[model samples]
Target: MTTPPFAPVTDADLAVLSEQLGRPVRGVVGVAARCVCGNPTVVATSPRLPDGSPFPTFYYLTHPAATAAMSVLEADHVMRELSDELASDEEVAAQYARAHEAYLRDRAGFGDVEEIAGISAGGMPTRVKCLHALAGHALAAGPGVNPIGDRALAMSTWSPERCACAQPGGAG
Candidate 1:
């Protein structure tokens, strides 16, 4: 048996996630990572929804600041630069491949989905498409797992080293 790489979700987590997303959170299996203040920074989700839909995103970034930073980077066209880096740099490309494997391993706990087999979100291994997905994988697996995610985090104004959360009832 393999140990899972995430923390279990709690009722408090569900509440905070609802606030972070401005909607109710669902299908979360675990708290993949946390803010320094213990907010749900990333969540591990089910591959198949209760409604029988296939959701490929296993590691989901939930913190508003992190998502906002990724949004800013995307608006700046960073994906193109990262994709070019993947094409030009062998070491980076290799690291991304490892990240893809890590993603698959992490997602395997939710069982398998045929439609998304061998497919991890954010264009892993050969491309850099979505910073949200890459950053989710990075935060969940920590810094060195995804090169693109690490780069994106470093490039962004938000830093995971701190707690930038506004918890429910102002506990933050």
Candidate 2:
């Protein structure tokens, strides 16, 4: 399995993340994906946070524009369409299952959290849910790894190739 590419987190990155999230980030292992402007788009968080909380959503989407676009897609009920596609298409289901395994493998690199041992974010391997998490995985894992995430990114108005970050050049 190909491990996802991520850069080591810096204090500057943490500040930018705090600004983007409107709160300080906890247990962020690395910057999973970046915007065209070099701002963090997705963050690879630890399975367990500093507060002893078991956080299962490892690939957390932090870019405001990307997150907003995903929220719009969810509001439009695009999830149902994707869910139907998953239900009807055998290839999609297979790909989604693989995506789930990939997610588990990626998270296992960090310490294991028993509370979320087998769980992956976004209702993976079964149903479509939370485009944000799926898109995060897509951005971090790169194209062709997560079909549903790729589809969600394709459908969304946001594009990683273009800079939509509020803070240009990842200014904190």
Candidate 3:
């Protein structure tokens, strides 16, 4: 099982994440992805929260702009289009399956939760339920790892290469 690369979390990172989420962040393991400006874009969360609840989503999207872009895409029914593509395209479907496996493997590195076992976020291995989850996984694992995620990122208005963070040093 290959472990997904994650940056060490810091107090400043938690501060930025709290600012982005508009609440105190919890169960965060590390910063999975960050904007070019050094602010976090995606965070790696524990499978089980401090409250002992089973959490399925390992890679969580935190960047407000990226989240908004994914929301717009979902509102425009991009999920249906992507689902259709998944159903019709065998190669893409296979790639998506591999992505689901990769997601599970990565999450297993953190810990195993029986509740979320064999379950990957974004309706992976079958459907495109949530672009936010897909995009978050793509950003965390990097390009070519999640084809659907890469596609969603391509279709979205947000770009990780660009700094859209409202916090310090993000404007450019």
Candidate 4:
């Protein structure tokens, strides 16, 4: 049987990647940044959900096709191929910064609200509850209040109350 390629990311590396992405480094996520041939790459430590659990951290080369693809096995292979190219901490940080900036720039034009709603619906109960809560909020806010409008604003502000899912440990 072929062994699967998998590796743990150091906390230091995760911090470096978080800095590059301009976000708080919450868990064990890291990116390879650049391959030996100077191609861009990305690595993410796939942490569990808000509830503690185990899952695979993913790593991948930054090819055009890999952007929309999510596969654990493929991510492992790409990480292995680029592992040899990892050199200095500074090099890795720089590469991560560049790749992250490119990613952010590329996502600048996407505006799919339905996609956001789908992601928010974690399961049947969550979906039903979220939709009901949204309906209540819409009703309370009145007919002129658009749920999508509220969602857009909540997204910009990161308000948990206005979010689709109930706040952790709070009422749905």
Candidate 5:
């Protein structure tokens, strides 16, 4: 049986994402370009939050094939490179604990513990989980504060149709 091909994000979808971000997307560029493997990467920069401050934020969306390839490549890279260091069960548990704690603390400003637990406990969907893992690796390799792997960015996807960032209405 043939597996259905993944759908690519279209220019119209990119335009929608740019619109939701409230800025003219600067086209595929830089780290966004790297993550998308040269696929068209849409970027909206310095988006403001009503009251202006240097938002210092960007939104990146890639073609679906590139997105999928990135996921696989990142996973393979981690497995081959970090497997020895992460081999022990104790080490794996410790890493999970650290990552989970970081996730909780980073999200704590939002509200109650129960709500936060509920949200995270729901289990991230497969694609999102992979992207989040990849983002973590990307950040660890970078300099400075390395904010790229945070839950907000990690949870984003190239599927503009399903992306809240690409669509209007409701706070995500």
Candidate 6:
């Protein structure tokens, strides 16, 4: 499997993550992808955290604008629509299943934490629980991998090709 490798997360990157998440980040292994503005879009986290938390979300989205856009979609009940589509579309379902498998391989690359083994974020393969997680995976893996993620990205106002990241203190 040719899963994408993570970029080295610098202290500055950590700072941006802290700001984006509004909390201190821990167990960040590497960066999965970045926004066009040179800010972290997806981060590859450890399966096991410092506090013994089994964090299954290996790919984390951190760009404020992208996150905000995902939130808008979720708030608009786009997940329910996507979930219905998953039930109705066999082709999309198969593609999503592949995405689930890909997620497992990438996390296993870190190390197997039995708790999260075979489990990927965003209710993948079965449902569309969270657009943020799907979007993060899409950004990390690139296009044509996660169908739901690609759909979400297409539906959202955010664009990977655009540098719409928010500056520190929520500036443009």
By TM-score, who's the top model here?
Answer: 3
Order candidates by TM-score, high to low. 3, 2, 1, 6, 5, 4
Q: Between which residue pairs do clashes occur in model 3?
A: none
**Each model's backbone clash number:** 0, 0, 0, 3, 0, 0
- Model 6 regions lying over 4 Å from their true place: 1-3, 168-171
The global C-alpha lDDT for each of the candidates, from Candidate 1 onward, is 0.88, 0.91, 0.92, 0.30, 0.35, 0.89
Sliding window of 10 residues with minimal summed lDDT for model 2: 163-172
* Model 5: lDDT to the true structure: 0.35
Over 1-172, each residue of candidate 4 has an lDDT whose tens digit, in order, gives: 2222223455544454444345754433333332222222244333342345432222222222122221232233433322332323445434434433332222222222332222321011111122222222222233333232123223232222331212122122
Which number leads on lDDT? Answer: 3
**Cα shift from native, residue 31, model 3 (Å):** 0.6
Candidate 3 residue spans exceeding 4 A from truth: none
Task: Quote each prediction's TM-score.
Answer: 0.94, 0.95, 0.96, 0.24, 0.31, 0.94
> Cα lDDT for residue 9, model 5?
49
Compared with the true structure, model 6 gives a TM-score of 0.94
lDDT of 5 by residue, 1-172 (tens): 2211223445754564455445654432222322222223333222233344322223233333334534654555533333333344454435444544443333333233342352331122112234434343233223222222333233444332332221333222
Q: How do the residues 77-121 of candidate 3 rate in per-residue lDDT, one tens digit apiece?
A: 999999999999999999999999998999999899999999989
Tens digits of lDDT, candidate 1, 1-172: 2537678788989999998989987788999888888888998889887887888899899898899999999999999999999999999999999999888877877888998899998998788889999999888888788999999999999998876777763334
Between prediction 4 and prediction 6, the one with superior TM-score is 6
TM-score head-to-head 1 vs 5, winner? 1
Decoy 1 TM-score against native: 0.94
lDDT of 1 at 27: 83
Clash pairs detected, candidate 2: none
Error of 4 at 61 (Å): 7.8
